[model samples]
Target: MPDHVLITGGGSGIGLAIARALAAQGHPVTITGRRAEVLEAAAAETPGLFPQVMDVTEPESVEAGVAAARAARGPILIHVANAGIAEGRSLRKTTPEFWRSIMATNLDGAYLSIRACLPDMQAEGRGRVIAVASIAGLRGLKGAPAYSASKHGMIGLIRSLSEDHLGSAITFNALCPGYVDTDIVTRNVESISARAGIDADAAMEIMVSANRHGRLIHADEVAAAALWLASDAASSVNGQAIEIAGGQV
Candidate 1:
């Protein structure tokens, strides 16, 4: 049997793509999401993908989901804290509620997921934790201050944990991608169009152009990065923010 991998937000987009890729490589995968139907649908389409209903924003939900996943496939050897929300707003329009919401899902969620899985990882003496961050995390992304802050917080959490576990068997890392072609990007494009009075296609093009290569990224590209981080090749790649952003800095 292969090692068990738990991926939060694995019902769709990059998370689901990573789960499928890992399962194809013989890993027993548990994919979690806030909606049971979404998770079940994803699991139905992908062999070896187990569905778990979880809301990363809620600690109770994360605890229950992790317990269920561990019960199904022993201790989780790979934990991907990939659940997050992305939104963009200027400082004048940003409200405390919106900022908190993004931080709750993107930063606090990753922290809680890591905390929930670390005990078992420590007990086992070996594990991998990957957070799906973004190039926005590396620096301010102009309009998405809240989203960028949350991502920055995630990298901060991962780096701190990596330092704490320096000599231990577990490793932590983050994948920073730019303009990945996911539903989130689509939604963001629509939001931008509405806010900036540009056409939807133009908004999308603007985002794609942000990448140095002038193209949108594939979900599989990010998934491949996750697989690399989880593989034996990345044993020494701890505390790194591996960028997949077509030269976006």
Candidate 2:
């Protein structure tokens, strides 16, 4: 059997896109999320997608989820750390609870998930670890200190891991994208509108204009980058953050 691929936050958005793309490539994929209904529904709609309800923020949940997935499928050869929350708040407005929450889900979650699935790759001597980071990781995003910091930490982790396994077959890389046209954007439209006292269209336009091409990026675009990074062709693309921001970032 071909090695299985495990993706966190695979119920929707870029995670779902990457899950479907990998599944269509004839790879058994385990799609994980915090919501069982969402995962089950997504798995039902797509073939070769196995639903594994998990909270990546929790170490025990990640370990158990991967073990269960391995029992059902084979060893996981690809691990996509795509589970994260996107929210922007000024440094003065950021609270301790909010900061910890972002770190727990965005940074700590990736660390735990990779640590759990990496052994399978070591046993087989080959694997792909793709993290769905953001351009904010490459540069601090204004008004979103926690989110930016979390993603920066995630990319740093990927870079360090690639160096730790420099001569190994396992490859570690990150995909840094600008504002994507996902549910997050939809939610952000309303939040930004309310926060900035602007109309919804204006708020949406602000995000749409954030990309250099003056349009929101499709989830498939990010998925394509991930697909490439997960392939043998990307064997030498380790410790790098490939930007897919519609134009140069």
Worst 10 residues of 2 by lDDT: 1-10
TM-score of each: 0.98, 0.99
Return the top candidate by lDDT: 2
In order, what is each prediction's RMSD in angstroms? 0.8, 0.7
lDDT of 1 by residue, 112-162 (tens): 888888888899899999999999899879999999999998998999999
lDDT of 2: 0.94
Model 1 worst lDDT window (10 residues): 240-249
What residue pairs are clashing in model 1? none
The sequence of per-residue lDDT tens digits that candidate 2 reaches over residues 1-249 is 666999999999999999999999999999999999999999999999999999998999999999999999989999999999999999888999999999999999999999999999999999999999999999888789999999999999999999999999999999999999899999999889988999999999998888899999999999999999988888888999989887887
